[model samples]
Target: MTETLRKKYRWDRIGLVLGGLAIFSFGLAAWVAPEEEQVGSVLEHPNNAELPESIPALRVQEIQTEKAKEPELDEVVLPCSCNRNVLKLAKNPYSDHRRAARNLPNSFFVKDSNELNAGKRNGKLVEVKDGRGFHISALSHSHAVLLPEVKALLEDLGNDFADLLVGTPSEGTRIRVTSLTRTVKQQNRLGRRNYNAIDEASTHSYGASFDIAFTDRPDNAADCSAPTRAIQQVLSQYQKSKRILVIPELSCMHVTLRP
Candidate 1:
């Protein structure tokens, strides 16, 4: 009976020690555990790893779509002044009106029709033939002739002049060549009608000068004035480019090749 009582006493002591240890372990776990609010929020809202990947792809597609909708602009190439100046080097010098109109050498004068024919045959002169861009005045056609270089210059000018007048109200307008080559005799006859004619030492005799009336129909005010300013603008471009020297005369614009 005494031995049994001692064993029971020892078991009671062991049980007390085990209960104390269990209480200490519960306190430590409670101190280290995360807050319920934080743990519950994390569980409710999972991280979306795929969201970042989709965002960049959507942004790239939006940028590409905007680029495709934008208008394509045409590339405009500007003309180089150096290249144009090089072309102007082919122009003549004495053609400028600033030079003294003194006794020009006999070689410079078209003394008669025979000399004019010689010039034409030798390719020194090009007869001004009426065609698409221009029409020679009836009085001038018979004697219309110019230096080959001058003729080419006029042809190019005429083409550009026509292009400028195109799409305007007076689109089909043609430039008029009122005077071209003039001999001493033709000059004498023209002098009777035109007070501005330079009877002696005229550049016309040299086959390097011509006159352009602003319009073919001088009598029609609607036709003459509409394109006059525009035509002058085109001529001014040529003058500035050094291709020709222009004299804005009362009746017409006198143009001469640069010597």
Candidate 2:
């Protein structure tokens, strides 16, 4: 072959090889680039811009963002059960009628009149005849009986009465017991005169309930209500402590022992 023709052929081969290498380098660059930066084999884009959404990926991101933005919920609490009145009057929360007698302690119920009468015969009861610290009601329920424990309760209440009367003109005044133990028959008879008589669960039959007289004067005299307020305060303290339940009636405080 001639020298010039051979040189031209060599140069042509060299150009072909260089062009192939350039094409290969561009393809490799596109393969190694991030998916967001590569649109197609020939196209490239800046990574700083947001890409168009794929349907599945977009839904997943939206769900994640919603979960993060949602508020967390809090736990809830319940209320107490005792919430009704007994005497058709405004309920004394101290003596909530919702209480079930089925769960009451054994000492709280007399079971039947026979058991109460047995208590009287067994000296488990004591006569609360009028004496130094208290007075009995003038009503037909004059002969009142109480459990020994309850009699002791009255004696302890005398101290509360004294504390109430402290620095007052009525200091050392005796408290009056308005009602005491009643037979089932007595309770049934009294039910006619009193609407609060519940023979089945009556603590009076058990010798565990008692009534004290109170009067509120609109005049608001100092120490005039000390007896009434003091007794009520003491009874309320006991009621809050869960030792007894007190019903603040129109004219008296009816108390029942926890036992």
Candidate 3:
């Protein structure tokens, strides 16, 4: 009977331990249930091991995107002093261009596109391209061709222009040639579109002239003051020497090679 009673006591202790473990497990489940439900909440995002991205990193990116914006209205852009003192620059008359375009030693009328192409084939009109101090812009209404002598003159002008600006802030600045040789058809089209177009045949139609619209400095390393002055000095020297005829138009500086 004593042995039987001892066996009963051991079983009772085992049952008590099992019951306590069941209660502990139930309490743990109750504590985790609320946390699991709140895992997807916007305001209470809990750390999740299964997430593909770092939770902290994603939050930082979102904050940055929300704060991103365009430039402010009052943001100041420094102005370049290109116009000051450069007003003394020559503004040549257009009538001289008309006279020189027809009478210049190398000038000849390019009546149409066919004549323009023929001039090119016969080596009368040479191909014009970028050189030392000048660059040809995308020509929309003109051919990239000029009289051989005219081309040479242009090259000399470019080289001299570059030399004049050497060691200055506008050292690498280049004059932008906006227009080149234009046929009669192209001239008419331009006349219809542009109010500044010449009333009669343009000097460009004769492959004797080009237009300089802007001087651009690479990298904005310097302001326009140096480039502007350099242009004035170079063009004025050429004009005074009677080597070229010029018309300082509203859009560009029209230049014609003079014999």
Comparison by lDDT, 1 against 2, better one: 1
Whole-model lDDT values for every prediction? 0.63, 0.60, 0.76
Local lDDT at 44 for model 3: 49
lDDT for each residue of candidate 1 in 138-208, tens digit (9 for 90 to 100): 76533888777778878887787678767666555567778887777777767766644544656677776
The residue-by-residue lDDT of candidate 2 on 226-246, one tens digit each, is 555566566667666776666
Over 4 Å off in model 1, which ranges? 1-95, 98-107, 140-142, 217-225
Clashing pairs in 3: none
lDDT (10s digit) by residue, model 3, range 202-231: 788878898787777774567777777777
Tell me the lDDT of model 3 at 129.
Answer: 93
Residue 231 Cα positional deviation in candidate 3, in Å, after optimal superposition: 0.6
The estimated TM-scores of all candidates read 0.54, 0.52, 0.66
Clashes of each: 5, 1, 0
Model 2 alpha-carbon miss at residue 43, Å? 99
* Candidates 2 and 3 compared by TM-score, better number: 3
User: Candidate 1: how many backbone clashes?
Assistant: 5
lDDT, candidate 3, residue 23? 92
Q: What is the lDDT of residue 91 in candidate 1?
A: 29
The Cα RMSD of model 3 versus the native structure comes to 8.8
